[model samples]
Target: MQSSTKTPTAGGRAAPAPWALVSVLAANMLVDALEVSANLVALPAVGAGLGLPVPQLQWIVSGFAAGFGGLLLLGGRLVEHLGRRRVYLAALLVFAAASLAGALTDSAALLTATRVVKGFCVALTAPTGLAIITSAVPEGPARRRAVSLYSFFGAAGFCSGLLLAGLLTAAGWRWTLAFPAPVALLLLAAGARLVPRDAPGTRAPRGPGWHATAGGLGLTGAVLLLVYGLSHLAGPGREPARAAAAFAGAVPLGALFVAAERRSPRPLVPPVLLRHAPLLRSALGAAALNGSYVGFLLVATLHLAGSGRSPWQTALAFLPAAAPLALSALHSARIAVRLGPARAVAAGAVLAPLGYALYPRAPGADPGPAGLLPATACVGAAFVLAFTALHLQATGSVPAGLQAAAGGLYQTFVQVGAALTAAPVAALYTVGRGPALWLVTAVGAAGACVALGGLAHRGRPRARARP
Candidate 1:
């Protein structure tokens, strides 16, 4: 788990240039992010082209999430067991293939399947990329800066996806789908050249055998059901009975997973990590922030559209929220290093609630771009301050061997937060924009408290154990 003096590479080849390595990995991160936002804007066009109903069309977005969120834990375990570089490269190739398939597919189900495949591939690549960074880069300012760059690219990719969708969907939704394939291919070629080789000693310990496999499958199934159930709960046509059934199913599967892991010599998730305060707090804080931001976005988008603004105008207006993100993220590492990740997160957390509170709350209120500027700017700034810090807190202290597993667990929290929050926020928006914004503000406030709570009794020394 210790930091290596030199970047790890296969067959004793020279380490890739740091810039090249980070850029390639960050680029892949961008591709994963683009999958989420680009399809969002293209959804209506996709439905029209495929003659799909509104309810089915929603799957295009939710399905990707299901795949991404469901298998994240298993993906993390795979990265550890299979080799980070190997898993990352293989997943990238599959992601590119899926993107190509998605672009060409005429059938709605097939397109959705392609999306799920791409998402699953992303689940593999994301944690591996982070694991690579944690292992290749030395800890301290260098690792912090590398993580900042990685986080920045993810933010930039989402924003770019929105703008790209606006342009590509003009030609056809297919163009939007096809664009990522070439970009992913370019990244794949670069990754093959740049990603460091994994050391042989890094694989999971021998002897868990079927216990490890069963635990992993059970955990994956449980998460899959949870995400799908949550989606059903929040989808346009809320299927409460089905959602309840899925939740009920997840309980036993999850219990079985716990049992299997307890018996396994090497559990998929190390039992100690379950008690890791930093990881748990970071996951909770990230979840709260992600959920609130996504909820806010949903409310803001609907509010803009209802006020008679064009889609392009609404997208452009939201630029204030996404444009400054990369810049802020670039500086987050420095901030976290200085103030500590916990305090930095708290600082960022405060801005979001303030932004939400400042916004006009009335259902009839038309907050044009000018009126909405404060809220968007605040939320954007919040991400800049907290996002990287949260990442730092979550994985920074984890042992090198468990980096991917830790990253997966943290990211699962984030994805679940975004997915679960968006649905309820949408359902609430139907009740009233005021209530929806209030809910977002409340979530943000709670997140801020969680972050601040981490700072309690700062610098207090732990009591010594008896000799």
Candidate 2:
């Protein structure tokens, strides 16, 4: 790609802030994050307006996760082959079109289809955006700052969606679906201007071989089946047999994919990469961060709405979590530098479970700020520490060429973790909120243990054997 250099002005003065490229990238991150949570608060209204049955309504959310998570590996490869700038811009255009279609469609099926399309577009763009940032920015404080800001925008987007959903759903659910269009278009225009073009003499790489292609397709199918089954677990028409079938079908598919990968000339995911300890750990940490956070939000939102609180009130209650999360993200890079990313992640792990544990102690209906504040704050802190650290840890070790794939792998875990935890947590809520909170607590504790082990191991210097 074209290098981000200082373009001279008419007066022979250099342009201000080479970091403007990061702004374009962060905007993409913001839009991607916005899509994840915006439809959440608007779901009830969407169901009513579209006259969708409760079971089908759940698909509106799960569909996106399925498409995004399932295709991320392939999407990453596409970025590698086709070029980052090309893939990113094209994805934005597709996203805008899908958003427009979603807004205008009256058919629930068509709208749901649009969500999946938009999600696939996000799968392409999100990792590519990160890849671009890492490639463009020099590693160290500048890259760290860029990643932190990028992550902050994502967290902020989720919070913004919660509030925006309340307002837009009040006007009409369509507004929530349509909001991304204009924002995406503006980003597209700015991106065309600011984003450096592909390097001269660089042609798109050839596609993967048959074995790799087969493995990728099979793996994507397995993931989709798994996510689909998990999402159905807590729905109104809970069908154990169907869910079981889907889960069962995924096993052989996944195994076959692994087998195929072993034989492929050029596997979509390099086998050696899988053995990278830091990358694996970061993937696990990403999963834990998202699973616990989304699980907690799902339960908390349900509790508030069930207690006769309005949508606005429920959204407001979540402000404690969002506000602290934003602030923590802003400063997390500094914390990581001081404590080390592993230790920072471990610290987050501890806080997350502690937060979940506190939630169960909150008194009867409408547990005021006094009860919820500590729990939300802890969760927020966990997010800031874990999310930023994991992003750095996952990408820091990878070579330049594989950075896009690394980003894809990291994000795939995130979506899978969120989807997997959400259903079980929703089911637990039916039993009791206490059970749900306890489950989250257990998960957090486990994640913390992993992080701590990594920290202790990293701290100890390697001993040399006597010659």
Candidate 3:
């Protein structure tokens, strides 16, 4: 792989500083991560401001996941065809515009539309950013370090967003909605100046054949249906029949998608990619990590709300959990070298469930931050260890050309896992917080087992680089 340190200049002058490229990409990641959690804290305020019911308000969150997860494969394909730098800049422009529109609009429908648009833009930008990093940074230690830094920035971004949400919501929920616009605009400007242009002589891929087109359509439909059904599973005015129908519809579409991909000349997801055990393991680990974390967040938020904690207090309560994320992510490259990636991931997998288990053991109602500290710390540690390790594993396993696709696939698993687990956990929360916490524990344990098993098989040959 080429070193990310230097790119050819327009007039054969010196390359832009490496720090400039890193800053632009990391800032882009921060903006994306901020969107995931910032609005979460402001949900109640937004609902009150827009006179929206809880069911409708929840869509503001789910709509983003649906658009992000559903179109990820297509986004990856676009990155390949349209060029990474081109897609990245275009997506940032759309994201900035959407953030402004979302803040200005009073209509809930318009706000939701903006969320979906931003989500779609994120689908393009996130993976492409990763691809750009992989393309610029050579494989081995430097790339590992770059990936670690990238993951650290993402974790820090999520933490920052949670804190920002509370501060912004105090002024007005719209402030939280509008915050990303300026950040995105700044990143876009910086990115245009610093980000490397596409390699010379690179051209767009040919149009997809009929089978590839069919498979892509089917896969997109399946993902949308699946996410929509899962999001509504525990929602107010829940419709079991609709959820069931949506899920049932998805199965056949998914089956057809697989069949069509097998026959396509230019498949969206190549069959060989499925056989890559390391990538698959990393993807599963990522899914489990994200799903359980989001589930915990949902239950914890509900518990805090029930305890009559203010939004600010609730955000503050999560501060302890976010602290370890950056520390762990930054040092994960060294940890992976010492313990091996699979073992490090396994350790994190075990730690997360242990943390979730603590939640159920807390004495009485309103356990407070003091009671929550141990569990929150463990959860944060798990994110620090697992996310950085899994990111390195997945991205390292893929070839240069397919880095964006791998990133999209990895991120799709993340969003889908969160959506899938959130529904059941949210449903269980209606019964009791204890049950939901236990469910998260059980899921985390399962993921730990998978990670441990992968560790035992670490002798498997690494994937060969593609031409």
Query: Listing every candidate in turn, what is its Cα RMSD in Å to the true structure after a full C-alpha superposition?
Result: 4.7, 4.5, 3.7
**Per-model lDDT:** 0.75, 0.75, 0.77
Model 3 deviation from native, Cα RMSD in Å: 3.7
Model 1 lDDT per residue over 264-291, tens place: 7767677767877778888889988987
Off by over 4 Å in 2: 1-21, 48-58, 104-112, 133-149, 232-236, 360-364, 395-404, 430-432, 460-467
lDDT of 2 by residue, 1-467 (tens): 22356877667977534478888888888889878677777766676788765446555666676668767777766766778788899999999999999888888878877877887899888777876787777789888778777878877888888888778877898998999999999999988877766666564467655675667667767866776576567545567888899999999889878888788766666765677677777888778777787778767766765566666766777777666666666777777778788877888888898888888444374756777788888887787777778777777767767665676677788776766666566665656788778877777777787777777777565332111
Q: Between 1 and 3, whose lDDT is larger?
A: 3
TM-score of each: 0.82, 0.85, 0.86
lDDT of 3 by residue, 57-86 (tens): 655676676668766777766676778898
Off by over 4 Å in 3: 1-15, 51-57, 106-110, 134-149, 205-217, 232-236, 360-364, 393-407, 456-467
- Give the candidate number with the greatest TM-score: 3
lDDT of 1: 0.75
Backbone clashes in candidate 3 total 2
